[model samples]
Target: MPILDPLSFECVSHSDEQTQRLGARFAQAIPPVCVVALQGDLGAGKTHFARGIGMGWGAAQELRSPTFTMLQEHHREPDAGARLYHVDLYRAERAEDVASTGLLELLEDNDGVIVIEWPERAWDQLPPEALRVRFAVTAPSKRNLTFSTQSASAWQTLLKFRKLAFGV
Candidate 1:
């Protein structure tokens, strides 16, 4: 994959629902063991977007940021085995702290998926082939999302997934 330019993928949503709408498609299309790094500021709608993914991932429960708790697992919607890991590194003060969380252990091809919020805080812990989703809040109800992939398979999936999300 190329060094992920901002233009490689684009998604603009005017509301949380719109963001989630796009996220729903991604969730449905996603394969297992995906490491997703969600980058954004406070109230950037990362949680809402992940909720959409949880719903599409067949999660049976609600999806929250797990910011304070560090990690939360949402049962796959309407199923089991297939799952989602919602992680927040907002409170982690150091890279070592993030490392001590056993990031390598988490990347071991588990049956579920991993979603990381505040990814900038855990840069070195992320997988090399992870999908990068950067969300920018333009207004109270507007957002711009940029997607990039670090591996060929992830890039291809992102392309196909973007087309499906746009229905074009």
Candidate 2:
């Protein structure tokens, strides 16, 4: 596959439902073993977006923030072996702390998709191919999302997501 230009695409979500719909389409189109680095402030809708991802990815359990537990694994079929790792690093202050959470081991195992919040805290540890998404609160009911990636597969996934999300 040919690598695409690392151009960013932006979308404005007017409600949590819209954000969830967008995220669902995004997860449905993305490849497995992908890493999505989410950057945004509190109440920026990252968790809501992640819930959509889990739902679209066929997660069997209820999707919730792993704020207290730090990591939550979502799997629809254990026998099928595909998993989704939802990691929150907001409480982790150092890269070592993030590393100690066994994220690297999971990445190496290539068992599923990884969606991380507060990824900037461990920027150095993330794979270079990771897709970067930024969410900004533009209004009380509106959030702006931008997606960018350099990896060929990640870029292709973004294109598919865009097409699916927008029918473009």
Candidate 3:
């Protein structure tokens, strides 16, 4: 492990399960109304990571990529009003395409936690406070996940996640 900066840190996942566990640890520390921007190539563990987030967040169903559907909403149990919105902008080519998914409204309303895949497609639309996670494939079953954000609260969240996931 390396020394982690307050605003950024890196974690290496040796398997899909490890990636998902890392994400689950993140979910434990994330705020109720937050945006997570997932950046990486296809099959870079975004969806699997998201699945762990959903599981940790106590979603009623499994979280899956909303590539074709564009968005998928998962309601949390015991508190059905609390929700998680998974958005995929892979098919979007412009900001206008992102607007069609009503993401801006969701962000403004602060209704629930939102996880966006292919966020580069609508960089301008994302909130400045959004936590950004970049993934890189290192081997057939290995990945490097880099988490970063400028927002103070988001950085604190990452710190908490680090303590929970890494015990340091």
Candidate 4:
């Protein structure tokens, strides 16, 4: 289902820290059993944003991109009772490759946050309720981040983030 109240919000970040701050807001605003689909080119600050998500979500360790290893798992503190699975599909050219990486299984488990970079590679396999976030490099050290959701439930969660991130 489409978002009954289709919403759009934009944030500009001049540094990695600012980008992460926006992501932290997103992490806190989004609900559980949610998928975050990140679409962006290289140097678009996707990883930085994911790092912020880990922090905002109360991860107990440093967050890192799984570009070469393809997957990284971060456990939240006991009080948080959550986890973050960071996945990079930059090398997964085929949907089959994405499947081989056990991403579909991870989504099916739905026990924690899953932040996917280069999500377009597994578009067909992703959930319809995913929060689609797009990133654009506007300058050498600047980025434009946009968040959108397709399903009604996802839209509701996006609205929460909107209020927290933009006070609107």
Local accuracy by lDDT, each model:
0.78, 0.83, 0.89, 0.84
Ranking by lDDT: 3, 4, 2, 1
* Candidate number of the best lDDT: 3
Per residue, candidate 2 scores C-alpha lDDT tens digits across 4-49 of: 3455688889999899887888888888778988899999999889
Tell me which of candidates 2 and 3 scores higher on lDDT. Answer: 3
For 126-145, candidate 3 gives per-residue lDDT tens digits of 88789999899999999989
Cα-based RMSD of candidate 4: 3.1
Number of the candidate with higher lDDT, 1 or 4 = 4
Q: How close to the true structure is residue 131 of candidate 4, measured as C-alpha lDDT?
A: 91
Which 10 consecutive positions of candidate 4 have the poorest summed lDDT?
1-10
Q: Looking at candidate 3, what is the lDDT of residue 132?
A: 90
lDDT of 3 at 16: 93
Query: Between which residue pairs do clashes occur in model 4?
Result: none
* Model 1 lDDT per residue over 31-70, tens place: 7778888899988888888888887777788787787788
